[model samples]
Target: MIIKEYRIILPISMEEYPIAHSYTTTAVIRQDLALGDDIEISKSEPVTNIRLPDGKRTSGHFVHKVYHLRRQVPKWAKVLAPKELLVLHEKTWNAFPYSRTEFSNPEFLKEKLSLRLDSICAPDRGTSENIHCLTPAELAQREIIYLDIAGEQIPRKEYKAECDPKIYRSTRTGRGPLVGDWQHSVSPVMCCYKLMTMDFKWLGLQDKVEKYAYEAERKVFCQFYRQMFCWIDQWYGLTQADVRAMEEDTCRQSCSRANRPQGLFGSKSAVLLPARAARLVPESKSLSLPLDPSTGF
Candidate 1:
């Protein structure tokens, strides 16, 4: 059966010295008709009803939810130890609702699968001293990188230019590209605008739209950033070795029980085997003991 939508209600407490409240988030996945029969409409889960203490004890209320997804992996998950896998799994599962769980269509599963494969094949960002820093203009000139659910790089840009100026501006400030505040630049607004123009033109972003594009871009990027953070927490928290060991242990236990060899042997097999051999030797001890006593007398 096709899953039209999936919802998960999570309860969290904001209580302590500061005060807190409870809330829930919802995520949606749908089939997109426009992108052919293959496109999937997916939305990330949103969080709500967060309570903070002021002087008022606010009762519970439902908050709005927004969906977000990012197609990139951070640089941290590659170095954690094997024991961290459980944490990774737990975090990833929890963060799934907040991530890009929807596909253009089920066919996008190939893309998704590619992402997973990329995570496996991509080299870990281990302790390399080669620090590459680029200005917004420089970064915009390079390729666009797409990441997967596991926060691994799945796609690389060839010679394709930027797709959207708004996206470029947002990327420079948001988590995807430049990250952090661009306001500190020589001419924050102008610098950002120029960077956006360059990157967007390169990526094919149209400049025809005006107004709150920057703000809109910011919001979109923030959503993406949140997803990336969730992924980072998920990935850094787990390792692959632990999963393998657990699976191996489970397989061994299953095989042993299915064969029932241990039960067939019984617990007394060691003692019984020796006793049976002694009996087969014929009890010469009795005759020997009696003969010795008679000779002594």
Candidate 2:
């Protein structure tokens, strides 16, 4: 098992993050659809009194997604790998400021592999206590990687001036063009402590595949947040109701669209990972703050 904690500090406030995140997720899902990946939102609803790993209960929204990604795998692998291996099942329990997502494949991988993501959002400057409450073994095995949205290097083909944090500025919030040391000086700064855990046991392929998964995850996180921040003006003033409406519309559209086959080759790094191009293995479970027994969100 490979465990890693990724800390991403953004120049957005805690209050605005939920909206921005929701908007970004919907947009990314749509982009995947446009690329010909079949996305199925089998479940999207509210949940209450959900038990946490720490024995507390919380309430929030839950979502289940299935990605049919045969086209996202290389042609050679398509001939070698089983069709079921190309499909992915995702279950997300989102209680704002804290969310847990699990990813797995059906049948074969359902028991041998596990991928989880636990996200804790805070308004601090990237230094919060051990929010996920890792056990001694987990703590010792985990690696901490900080994602610098503005400073990280990107491939030329993947770079977009519009999404570059060093260039774009939000007109509405006036919070942009994050320069060096922005994580320390930006107003209303927030941090997302994303804990990712992956346990894959195969024929000597575990280590290589796990390493590639982390790299792919880092690429996704950096690019996703860069776009999220750059598109701040669009999601800045959106309310929960507005996001919900947009999601409903997206769900409707997804249901109506035909599930066309596509290719594994794409501009996005998430799809171009040569090792496992079709699967996204980001996941988590948690510990730091007091769980609101009443609301759970």
Instruction: Tell me the alpha-carbon RMSD of every candidate.
Output: 30.2, 7.9
RMSD of 1: 30.2
Tens-place lDDT digits, model 1, residues 252-281 = 342343342222111221100111111111
* Top TM-score model: 2
Provide the TM-score for each candidate, comma-separated: 0.17, 0.82
Candidate 2 per-residue lDDT over residues 116-215, each given as its tens digit: 8787787887786577788888889988888899999999998989999999988898887999888889998898888889988887767766776677
| Model 2 misplaced regions, further than 4 Å | 74-79, 259-297
Among all windows of 10 consecutive residues in model 2, the one with the lowest summed lDDT is 288-297
Clash total of candidate 1: 22
For model 2 the TM-score comes to 0.82
Q: What is the lDDT of residue 214 in candidate 1?
A: 30
Overall local distance difference test of candidate 2? 0.66
